[model samples]
Target: MRAAIGVWRWRRNPLRRTTDLVEAWVALVAVALLVLAVPAAGWISGTRTDASLQRAVQAQTRQRPVTTARVVRLAEAPAPGTQSPESAGEQPARRAVVATWSAPDGTTRTGTVATRRELSDPGDTFRLWTDLDGRPVTAPMRPETAHAHATIVGLLTAALAAVFVEAARRLVVRRLTHRRYRRLDRAWAEAGPDWGRTGAGS
Candidate 1:
């Protein structure tokens, strides 16, 4: 609909310039890409993202296992306004503590793990995730979370694509306008030398 409105001059306009026809074609192409190509690109991006996330979810689920750990002692919480190197980018809601758990092979292992609750004494049990070596690990990725991520990625990709199309359209129009202006200037210069001369007006 928009393309039809934009290209109306090309159908039957006696006064239309070459620039008008070129711009009408450009507008039609831009509209086609915005309506068709943009959505296709977004869908492809989102599908790829979802597939990659699902693969990661599978890998993490296979490598990490849930286990119970006994807290040997609570590590000192970070000082106010300061963060530990290990806790960089991690939420402050959880604190690190020393704990011990048994691996799948029935061998005992001890390490520092993050816990939601602050433990004051030894032997306090807490739920934890561990790798095959009994080392503490982050929880596995959820499918719902992956879906949300994919949705955001798709939306951002579509928006960026639209912006690019708009920019390209504006660039083409500006170039066309400049060309028209240069042609007008040349015509005026050629005609200026004959102004007011006999038979020039005729």
Candidate 2:
């Protein structure tokens, strides 16, 4: 807005320099890119990222399934006075337990796994995620998480675009200012001798 006003106010001024017009035009161009191009670039990048993440989510969900595991024994607890600060929180504490569960092929598998359940007795059941081969695996990415990642990517892209535009504008303006300064210096050098002499040029 200030750039537009500067352009209009200086349009008919006899004292206006070429650099002033160029600076105003540069500001206007930067504004146009920020207003129009930045959002488009961000949206396109975010859409592509979201689509790729969603595909990965689908693949993970299909490959991993929840299965029931029966606790055989609770693993050894930490020594007294050695617990982490997080143990005092309301969140359920995770503990390693030796558990057995049936594989997809109907074979019984037993392993030490971590669980948040308070059950300590054998035969206690808890849910576990495993690959098709019954190997323990983490849960698939949630759709909400994918969307959040996409949003962050979009915001970063937009911010980078704005930074680049401002940088270019400043670079061009700096060069113009230097050129103007050099011209003023040359003009002063040429007129310095006569400047202080009364009626020298007249």
Candidate 3:
């Protein structure tokens, strides 16, 4: 739509200069790229990022297995009003406790695990995730979360592409303007000396 309005200079008009036609063509090409290239770049970036993240999530799910562990000992709880800002919104703050669980090879392993409940017993069972080495680890990433991340990356990429396109268009227009000014200056210099003559006005 914008390109349609800008290309009016290319229509038959006695007042239009050669530079006007060049600028109109430039605007047309810039508009074409803005409409075609930017979205293609964004989709490609997003799809690749999404695939990579999904693969990582699957690998982590396979490497980290969920196992049942018994709480062996409870750690000291934080003092009142001592919670960090990041955990302040969490209800019934989680506490770390030393726990023991059996590995895939039937070997017993002990590690600290965070629990929302206050566990004082020696045999309270809870589910936990463990890496291949039987070390405690966080849960696997959700597919929805990965998709959201990919979407944000795509939008950012598109925005940056748009900025670059506009910058390039402005640079081209500036160069055209400079060239037009130089041409006008030369034309004036050639006609300036004869300005006082009667026939020179033509």
lDDT of 1 by residue, 105-133 (tens): 78888777776665525888877777788
TM for candidate 2 is 0.85
Which candidate number would show the highest TM-score if scored against the true structure? 2
What's model 3's overall lDDT?
Answer: 0.78
Clashes of 3: 0
Per-model clash counts, in order, read 0, 0, 0
lDDT of 2 by residue, 89-150 (tens): 62356667788988877788988776666754688888777789998777677888888899
Model 2: residues with Cα > 4 Å off, grouped in runs: 77-92, 119-121
- Model 3 lDDT tens row, 1-202: 6676767746778888887887888888888888999998888889999999999889978998889989888856532232334344653656767789988677899766676575536678877777788877776777877898898898889889988988998998899999999998999999989978987767
Instruction: Please give each candidate's TM-score.
Output: 0.82, 0.85, 0.82
Candidate 1 residue-pair clash tally? 0
The candidate 2 region of ten consecutive residues with least summed lDDT is 78-87
Among all candidates shown, the one with the greatest lDDT: 2
